[model samples]
Target: MIKDIIANTTNIKLTVIIRRALQGVASNNNPYLTLILQDNTGIINARLWDVSATDIEALVAGQVVTISANSLLYNNELQLKINDYQVLSGKEAEKHYQNLVISAPINVEKEWKDLLKTVEDFDDAILKKVVLHLLKQNEKDFTTRPAAVRMHHNVRSGLLWHTATMLKTAKEIVKVYHDREINQDLLYAGVIMHDFGKIWELSSQLITNFTLQGNMQGHIVLGSEQIGLACRTLKINEQEPIILLLQHLVLASHGKYEFGSPVLPKVLEAEILHQLDNLDAKITIIDDALKPLNSGMATNRLLALEGRIFYKHEGEKKKK
Candidate 1:
């Protein structure tokens, strides 16, 4: 696994998928291949020195290869010094595909089943129908796609893990505000639908890049449009109360206009959805940052957290 690469590990043999491949030139105009390799656990960077343009273009993303390398740790970055590598293809690549794909640790089937059931149990009939219809329509991608290209939940099945966790958090929050008459159905539907368009926004599991439509319109716009499409398909008016509210939640869930929300959240449920969504994504960012650090060591600045660094303590408290 890429995660197991460390300073003292002198030499290793591994099979991984090429997540990215690019050619760069040095001052002398020597061509080198810059490669981002990925496996189930994590990813690592590597350099293929003295490579031709042909080598760089031929090694496209999503190609599986086995490498023989000596670990080189330089300036706090670990890179593979490739002594040799062989591209695996046909049946051989298929054999390693399952192990190389990064995935959320959650049980995919159970989480997916429960997520569907949550929608099915919604007391609001209109909300229930729209959410279930859209979710089932995109079940294949929603169940397996990554939530992002590189942020929190950037692994296969990460979309489910992030959404499921947010759903659970929203459920508990609804109970806490029991007397407030908060719309649990709307909040829950918002959580699920907020990022559902990512199924089309991001590339397939092997290489998680933004599609042209994603780069142009983004998930928020795409999701809101998806809701509008669903309403039309079900013969529900786009201006119907529930349809409008759901679309609004999807639109304003990013919270601020600066963050790409065209309008601020006017509804309480939309605001709550924004908070919970940000909370989950930020929590995952922190957890992922702390992973490779030792006690008393601080992480490098994280752009995801506005360039703040985090420290890992010696030990964590046990759950009772």
Candidate 2:
């Protein structure tokens, strides 16, 4: 199994999906390929040195292939040195494809149902209509798609998991700040809509990739545009302050311009949604990084967190 083949494993043959493949030239000017391989268990980096042009051409992302590789530690993380690899075909490829996609840890169906219930229970009629309309329109992909190609919550049904968790967090936060002039309805709606563009941004394949629109427009722009379309479809008043506020929530979700947000969070609700979105995404990254480590060990540098290393304490207790 992919999980069992770790550092020190040598000459192991495995059937895997090519999550990513990039062609490069070595220091000696020899052609090579850097690959991110995946299976149902997890993903790992692999290098193919001195590869032929034909090999480079054939190794496409999302293709199934069998490889013989030696597992070793590089930069404190498990990496594979590919001895040889071949693209699989026919029934062989199909069989491996069925078993190679990883999914969200939570029950997707349950979370989806709970998400719908939350939307339906919203006290604000306009927010309720806007959110429900979008959810219903993209129901299948919304529930099944990964939140990203390869970032926080990038598993099957991860969009649902990420959105649901944010909604739950927003609910608790609004209650604590009940005295503050917070709009609970907007908070809930923003949380649901913040990453809605990812449904169009990413492919729903086993090894997710950016769609053409995703590459060109990204999630923020696409999300904002989506909100605009939904508003127009519902015949929502253009003069309504809520319409602009909702658009701001999606546009400024990244919190700042350098981080890809076209605008910064201007309203209190948008700001809170931005912070909550960052918090949930970061926590998920930390959790995923620590899962493969034993107690008292430090994780390999996390690429998602700017190469920060996290330690797992033996008696560490989760925050309540």
TM-score, each model?
0.93, 0.93
lDDT of 1: 0.88
Candidate 2 on 4-30: residue-level lDDT in tens? 876898899988999899988999999
Candidate 1 residue-wise lDDT, 243-273, digit = tens: 8999999999999999999878999999999
Q: Lowest summed-lDDT stretch of 10 residues in model 2? A: 237-246
Candidate 1, residue 294: the lDDT equals 65
